[model samples]
Target: MTTGVTGRLGGIARHARPRGPIETLAEVSVSVESGLASDFRGAVKPGGRGRRQVSLIEAGDWAAAMAETGHSLPWWHRRANLLVEGLDLPKTPGTRLRIGQVVLEITQECDPCSRMEEVAEGLKAALTPDWRGGALARVIAGGVIAVGDTIEIIEG
Candidate 1:
């Protein structure tokens, strides 16, 4: 038995340079070799080592985190590659997410780092609990991913 595709890509964003501002995108190319095309992370850390090709954040969880901390910042402030909705992001490594034509494997929790504090005061603390921050994943099978694309979870 397998779960069906139940989530959608709520949003997409890219950070061109390290610590640079995020640019929202309608669609982007994905590859097992180079995560999201033109994204700085893949370029800076080429090769699929350490499972950091792409990052995903649960839209609902983000909203909760913001509401809890009274932070009204944009979703891109988290600097993740994809904003997912309608499905609980699996925190466990080995989980696979199929987004449109692309596929990603959950490598680890994209834990809230000190960078979250830079984005908003107390945000780091807010994301510390409940896996609010997001999930870090590596591109397993690659293709084009866009906003509104369907997302499927394949348990590992």
Candidate 2:
């Protein structure tokens, strides 16, 4: 039923390692082995198999959360890897999406953490409902993705 649905890529960001400064980029390289090469989350640790390879959030959801929290923090403050627009991010896990040449599967929600409140009061609560915190995904196929790239749900 989701066939043909599409969205636009709005932004991309990554951190070198845990709790490191986040850097926004115009484009990024993604792979099945490593989610985003520049992102520390991509590194496959001994037990980390890359299931949470990438993180994504919808612009609409972010705006709504900001409105509710009375804060206008940058999308990256949510600490997701990609910002998307237009497409409805599935609430159910296992949804697959294609961005440029990269294929990603939604593994779970990017659950809001105490880190959110550390950024702004009530932010965690604002991002709590309706998948607002974003989606966590694993790279199924490697490809280069740039800002403004088209994103689509891939139906099997």
For lDDT, the strongest prediction is: 2
Candidate 1 Cα outliers beyond 4 Å, as residue runs: 43-50
Cα lDDT tens digits, model 1, 90-130, are 87789888898888889998888999898888889888786
| Model 1 / residue 68 / CA error / Å | 1.0
Residue 4: error of model 2 in Å?
1.5
Question: For candidate 2, which ten residues in a row score worst on lDDT?
Answer: 42-51
- State each candidate's clash count: 0, 0
In terms of TM-score, how similar is model 2 to the real structure?
0.95
Itemize residue pairs with steric clashes in candidate 2.
none
- Which 10 consecutive residues of model 1 have the lowest summed lDDT? 41-50
Q: What TM-score do all the candidates reach, one by one?
A: 0.93, 0.95
